[model samples]
Target: MSASPHPLHELDPAPAPSVLALVPAPAPVPAVPVVPANRAPRANTPLMRKEHRDNIALFRYQVIRGAADPSLSTRQRGPLVRALALVDHPWPYGGTRRFSRESLDRWIKAWHRDGFDGLKPDERATAPGTDPSILLLAESLKREKPNRTTAQVKRIITETLGQAPSETTLLRHFRAKNISTGARPVATGRFETVASNEIWVGDALHGPRIGGRKTYLFAFLDDHSRMVTTARWAWAEDAIRLSAVLRPALETHGIPEVLYLDNGAAMSDKSLARTCAKLGIKLVHSAPYRPQGRGKIERFFNTVTSQFLGEITVTDTPMLPGTAPEAGSQIGSLEELNTLFTAWVNMVYHHQQHSSTGQTPLTRWEASWEHRTPVRKPLETIRQAFLWSDTRKVSKTGTVSLHSNSYEVDPLLAGTSIELVYDPFDLDGEITVNNNQGIPAGTAKPVDIGRHVHTKVINAVKDNDTATNINTGINYLDLVATRHRQSLSGAPISFADLHDHTTPKNQTQPAVSEEEQP
Candidate 1:
């Protein structure tokens, strides 16, 4: 009945199948080849065509460039698409040509990131000795010679900083800093004068004509000292051009707290207003047609006219034979005139004691600046002074036409209305353009197709010189003889009388010639 004692005792339960030990079976793992660490991953193997990578890179590049340009409308994106297609035409298939779109994309991406630097083929590396201090030195030199050439700028830097960079290096520095030459602005805001140099009065004077030509005199005088700080000749009195002359006064004598000027066409330049704002100088405009507010300078010029220009002429010639009347002279030439004027200013004008200051203008100016604080302005802030305003429409080529001249803009601004703020003083046609929102789009140099506001040769040369020489071919004898013939008065006058009638146009009006006198 017990069935042989459950048989468990007889077999010993087969030792419980050795529960403490495990039997190992052979693995079914596939064979794997060992790869060296220097080898690339399988996914990056050259089994794929190199051209394929290049094509993809080219496609990506075009897309990215297209998206970044807001000026390129969808309708106008044909060129971009076509360019991409051409660039990606030969996909990498591991043929004789092995090119990758990725490489093209890499270069393009770099260019977008770095401007000219992005295009550097790696041959033109950055300067080795460049430092932040070099930037400061470059900036200082830029302020002094804003219109300097790259070489000139480098020379100045080397002279002043004792370390000159190459022209290319200097240009790179300037481009990085956005250093540009522009005209300074006129004064703006309310005009107030508490002390001398606190307010300077500027005006234009019509000086006596020498050699039958007119000349312009621009002057800036301290309101209190009545001292003429600066004066120079110009054909026309434009506001922006005048500002250039006043710049030295501002830099050397210190900026006046305010300026008083007439409402001449030249004084109404928007750049002048912007300049005053940037420099924190207030501009006061004289009441229209009322010359009293600006009378100080007006009177000073009158005194100059009466005491100097009128009494003496740079070209001394007897007024009339045996009359002994005071002779008049010409300033000789523009250069000679400038030298004389400088001498007169330094030796006679500035050194002379002012009635108001009881000290020389220089002395008074020095004293005034002693207690005065110099206005410090960043180069950008000062650049704002040179900005002038003109409303213009973008042309088909994104150019704006002004004063019979055309200026270019970024392609994105095409068909847009823009306000051009330009420096009239910059002979190079530099300008700052802005949108209606007052955001500066950027600075540009326009193609100058118009006459300059100020030129050294003077208008007389332009008018009188049929060629390069400064003569109009009018003879005194021809004029006097013609006049004498007309006034014969039935008297039996001989050819000798005609000879006696010979006199210059200065002495009397010439006889009416068949041709008109210009």
Candidate 2:
């Protein structure tokens, strides 16, 4: 009764069904492939960079993919687009920064096409070694005279290429690539003087071709300051050119105590030595086979080669004369080249820290400010000293002959030996006549000549025409007299024939030649 104890557990509720037993076994878990340990881990190498770049590139891919999806509305796209520029991402080598969405798009394409390898930076296709002129010169130098001394090879390369690699860069390349001609190393032991203007070393460096002609740079380097005194590109490496560069340098940088140079013919000329002596500069020459003495200037020239000329020489842009050049190429003439070099020297080189002196050349040169002692010679005297000179005796008529032209000298200079100082191009501008004691006698003027010495060769044609006019009054009077006489003598006077057919009756006209008559 009492429901039999409410079924007293009703024989226990039937056991609940096992949910785990009823559920189907999960699909076998996918095995995560383990990377092997022995494979060299790319640490700080380009390869390691490639992996990080790949992940970043994948992210970019996903971003772009979401952008193309119609499901991503403007609300979603706006922030995503803004985040590309604002959000910082790890860059491979240059450092971490935000990239342009466009750049991200490019990387994504790179990775999609080439996989991880595409993410690596591409090697530069244009290196100094790959330059056609440099390579040809290097190979030619090695082949022509195998086993040339390194120094000899260096000189050859410098002369041929108009610039040569630094000794260290060249030698490293030579050893690594077997391009060295077996040769002895350079001998060391050099003399160095202190103070910026105390000593200056001068040397010549071949320069890149301008148009069809090659150039040679005559330069002087301040030993103490490492400052380039003056540099000019010349077609000839002679005393004239050297003096041309030296005079300006002396004027600007002050006279050096000693001028050191190699045994080049131009450097050893008596004219340079005389000039140096006159300026109180002790001219010193390095012993044969001793370039170490001029190491400063040589290194300076090397810097010009590597820093200035190298950048210009690597250009592949063709520069045919008369043809317009591509942008960034100012290499049209020697003047332009020097203009560029001057700007570079005054603005860039003078301001930069030198590797050896740890000071800018201008700063170093200016540092010992009180040490400067410029020459006191009059500018005219300095000018005369630098210019080309010759002696000629004035004729009795106060005239002198030079370069096959007659010049009128001072009346007092007549029948006396005098020195002629003048520029070769300025014959008409006249020249200064100095006595044997170097005192100015007077100025000489070139005699007038109707003919020009040299006519310009131009591509255009010009007209050289002449005409003559004579008064017709006398002829007209004679005609009138004849006509009156003919009337008085009863001869016919045809008034119709008295005037020109092309002119009015009262108008005066020129008499026509017999050949002009119809």
Candidate 3:
């Protein structure tokens, strides 16, 4: 049975030649050549020289602008052409020989069809020979008195050649003559102060709505230190709100020499100017539409928007727990918003290194602060100095009218003119009435004249209006020693001296009093 195997079914017959290996390899593929439609613009390839190129560019810009200008009327072509021809046109390459009427028409048509690039000559393998006349014209144009426009140029060419030249053609010849048409480079200005607190920039920011009402943040930034002196949130962008913010900053950081402000509602108010005048603060407003001077405050606002508002504002996704959970009560209370903002400012912002200062704002401020002497004033003094004042006579009811509200005043001041020092937005509606002697008579609280029509007594003054000042300077004790010394001499004494004294010496007193001596 083993010998009966068929030979056609050989167990180890050689495999048929592999078809893939046997087949001849296809011819190597040829890469598709990439042909550029246009050559790159070369610096030296243009017909016009460097200066002439800019002139041509300026010409082109002028024509393009004129073409689109609704001011030029096409109806008076004759008069228009006549008027335009009188203008002294500048041509860089040479005299405006190429600027002919027919030329202008053709170029303008081409421009209409294909925009700016259309005015350029068709591709030429070799640079066309430069025209000396055209070159001369371009130079003259650049130097031409009272720079000329395309139409005026076209008219001039017409007058000289008896046929108007093509504005488009002339512009094309000088296309790269100059880039005078390009926007002027923005001039960078330095607005920083040399020393910290020398200058402060203030501006108001429109913040997220609270309780369906818009909120504004008034902030002051020290230009040199890049430190925000104070920031207050308010419902209105009024002078009163601004004063509230500015006073605190003045108290804490001392007064800035110059207060750079914008011509906005908060800074432009008359009260703000008056306040600055009183404090010897030079209030400077940036030129209208110019924000270069307010860069510091603007930058601060940018930081606030990105860092603080981004995290806490109700508009953001990651708002505080109670922030705008509902539309009725915006963002937790303003107190909460203020609390969070203050913490960030004191704990985070003041400690961070400022990009401009290369030191933490507070640190940089302190560095200058070492050598600088800020006239630190008490908050009450600042308030008193910053108050808005106007003279008004007290009424028969011992009252005065302010902002349409009547205030009850001292009966002694009845029918007397008094200078009222007050916060315009006095929460308690109280006015500090000062008599002619500059004495604080009393607080005039808002009263309903109708409510007190028949009342004989007026209790407008607060019981605490006793006006107690702990005489920090020149106290009785200071003069007591002088008095005792004078008693021994039996003459008058003036010990507590307080005039022109930048620094006062500590006075000494005898251990035992005169009366206690045996």
lDDT of each model, Cα atoms only?
0.51, 0.54, 0.53
Ranking by lDDT, best first?
2, 3, 1
Candidate 1: residue 478 Cα off by (Å): 36
Greater lDDT among 1 and 3 belongs to 3
**Residue 473 in model 1: shift from native, Å?**
29
lDDT of 2 by residue, 1-518 (tens): 23231110121132234422332443453322223445434434456555644544444444344333334333333344445657775433333467775565455456557764565555434355545566555555555445444444454465434677665655555564556446433322256556777888888888886555567888887787777777766555766556656664554456778888999999997667767766777989989985667777776666566445633421224547897432122354554445445545554466668767789988877776675554455444554455445799989999988767788988887888998876433445557889878898888887953322212101001111111222222221122233333222111112111111232122111110011000
Which RMSD does model 1 reach against the true structure?
33.3
**How does candidate 2 fare on TM-score?**
0.45
Clashes of each: 21, 1, 34
The residue-by-residue lDDT of candidate 3 on 262-333, one tens digit each, is 898768877788788878889899899877876667777766664456444243234477753321112334
Prediction 3 TM-score vs. true:
0.43
Provide the lDDT at 334 for model 2. Answer: 56
| TM per prediction | 0.45, 0.45, 0.43
